[model samples]
Target: MNLSILYRGPLSSCNYACPYCPFAKRRETPAELAYDRRCLERFVSWVATRTGDSIGVLFTPWGEALIRKWYQSALVTLSSLPHVRKAAIQTNLSCQLDWVDACDKAKLALWCTFHPGETSRERFLAQCRVLLQRGVRFSVGVVGLKEHLAEIEALRRELPAEVYLWVNAYKRQREYYTPEMIADLTRIDPLFPLNNTFHASRGHSCRAGASVIAVDGEGTIRRCHFIPTPIGNIYDPNFADSLYERPCTNDTCGCHIGYVHLDRLKLYDTFGDGVLERIPYGFGESKPFLENLSHAHLSTE
Candidate 1:
């Protein structure tokens, strides 16, 4: 069974300056701004019609999602859907507490990340408390590094037990994991061990075109949000089927959204083994990487 229905959209502007994040420079345009609500409504309606097991829908944004003007309408629309049991948001936790309260009201689990340069540890913990009191199931996402260990530990203690805490490995822009980084994270947070078990293993074997779906601001169904890749328009008649058949050819597919989707699909080996072998030497475009991986697969056969 898959932890399916990852409804990720890049529909916000961030205030952080994280050097390692791929979407660090993301910003929404005027045209893109108005499309999120419509796309989200259509997407949720489509998801509700699907008869399936419990699915988790993640509203992961490139920037601080709470700051987006259309965030509330999108949240209300997605949360109100009948089929979605678990709806979550991945945010920087830099927004005001009211947004946390809104998330709580909508029964959306909050996944907040702690960035030293963006927000202080104290403030992050305070927001955690707000989420807890509001009856929201939440987690603190710690960037896996020695320097952030103390703060993560402190937050673990200060926050409630139900507020699940996890440690995430540091991902530099457009780069996959090194064995060294994995080793380091294993050493740091043993209880919350985070291996690049999702995308690092799966690589280009993404079934995003087949089953997973992401909608951009213009109501277009994209393969994944990391690149400006679109497979079909959600407004089309065969949108779901169209997205379910998209493919990826990325060099290293350990991106957060891609990896999360991989993990949801329980395709860790597809991410890990594929990533290590498929990533080509040339720097530009994913086609060459796909070609190389195809050759490697043919040779194995």
Candidate 2:
């Protein structure tokens, strides 16, 4: 399959401050969110012309896209690209429920992450109903944990047949799954599969060095979210020419970004057993990244 895009940004507000969430303690900054918009536009436009109609785009942000005013416009911009034949967003089903009509206007495929404690089954179902009415495609994901397994199963049954419901392993909080919980998850959607590998059982190496690239809230390309290594700048005039040649410099990676980078190295050591050490020779340079660039490497699809 061609590289699919997984685009994310920091959220403006978080209803539930999950301890494991990276942005859990982060407060929303409208100014930073707005800057993210400009950086996103520049990155997308550059990708369109450089890659040119060969990839699918997945729209996602750290918090929730609907919480920011620029998200709707960002969706509009992404849909305008011909290379962006497919578009999806990972959300918490909070604000989008209120603006289902606006989401439909953006021609996006919605990927809703349901938090049972913070979101109610009735409210989630209401949003699903609205999405179906708008003719927008969507799916539901429940964080896999002993606490939410039952609720996840109920949501799966409650979702429309056309909408797929899957379970996401709760990585930040490592909790054992009871046999009952496993049985419950298996019964919810027998064919249910996780789309994100970050929380999945680790084994695969990632090809992010050559294929995956990300631009941060600024416009610079970095290695991955887990590592703070800078590679190139999407906003730079020469970005298109240098996008694929950037190098990886991370020593330890738990997220999918690390997996992709390691995968590209053809280092298929199993989880907790791979070449988890950084290059002793360094990243080869210590030049300053552009002041306007702050984004990390956008992982390869």
Q: Kindly state the number of residue pairs that clash in model 1.
A: 13
Which lDDT values do the candidates have, in the order given? 0.54, 0.53
Poorly placed runs, candidate 2 (over 4 Å): 1-3, 10-12, 16-26, 44-51, 96-107, 172-175, 189-205, 240-301
lDDT of 2: 0.53
Over 83-180, each residue of candidate 1 has an lDDT whose tens digit, in order, gives 55556667777766564444425447666777866677788788777766777655566776556656666766766544445566554433444566
Q: Cα lDDT of model 1 overall?
A: 0.54
Per-residue error at 90 for model 2, in Å? 1.3
**Off by more than 4 A, model 1:** 1-12, 19-56, 99-107, 173-184, 187-207, 226-229, 243-248, 263-301
Among all candidates shown, the one with the greatest TM-score: 2
